[model samples]
Target: MNDKKKKSDTNSSAENVEQHLQELEKADYERLYYSQEQTFSADELARSINEQRLTELMAKSDEFLKSLNSELEDFDD
Candidate 1:
């Protein structure tokens, strides 16, 4: 029974990840990636993941989002 519960929990978590991915826009890379050359480049994405460039990715994403949000606010004015 305990093993069955563990399996069920793992399956549910996997499903949630799949659902979240499905809900995301396929063009999100265009917004998140600042480099024109790396946009939609599978090799670059693989390298980033394999090299564990988490901090770099996080910082770049944060910067783009901040600029995008500020632009949107100004546009709405």
Candidate 2:
């Protein structure tokens, strides 16, 4: 009888754990779905701004290098 009781208790505990895990998974799925829906446009805007800034920096760097090359050529002469 004692052994049977222990077995029953273990099975009950396992079922409870399984139920909790399922709940957590459901919550996670819902959270991810909503978060993506909310952030998609904001994410795109952020990416566009970052790309524009990168392009501007590249242009400035190229101009600086060209000017430095000209200065070096003057020094060589």
Candidate 3:
């Protein structure tokens, strides 16, 4: 009886995981996460803005976004 209960629990867990994955795949994630470029006017803004290193931050954020999607793909497998 205990063996049967364990098997039943395993199957239920697998089914729940599969259902969650299906729901995840159905989401419009791209539209939900779309990022448009931002622009600011004026050649001379705050010195702090110039020193913020936006270029390096953008590069790092892009890499982070790519890794996020790759992590989801890993879960799919």
lDDT of each candidate versus the true structure: 0.77, 0.89, 0.76
Candidate with more favorable, higher lDDT: 1 or 3: 1
lDDT, candidate 3, 1-77, per-residue tens? 99988877778777988988888876656445552344555654564475558888988999999999999999999
Q: Which candidate wins on lDDT?
A: 2
Candidate 1 lDDT over residue span 5-72, tens digit each = 88777787779788778667555766566555544668766766745567788889999999999999
lDDT per residue for candidate 2 within 1-77, as digits (tens), equals 99988877778777978989999999999999998887457778787677877899999999999999999999999
Candidate 1 runs further than 4 Å off:
1-52
- Please report, as a residue range, the 10-residue window in candidate 3 with the lowest summed lDDT: 30-39
TM-score of predicted structure 3: 0.38
If scored against the real structure, what TM-score would every candidate get?
0.33, 0.39, 0.38
Model 2, global lDDT: 0.89
Tally clashes: model 2: 0
Error of 1 at 44 (Å): 22
Count of residue pairs whose backbone atoms collide, per candidate: 0, 0, 0
TM-score sort, best first: 2, 3, 1
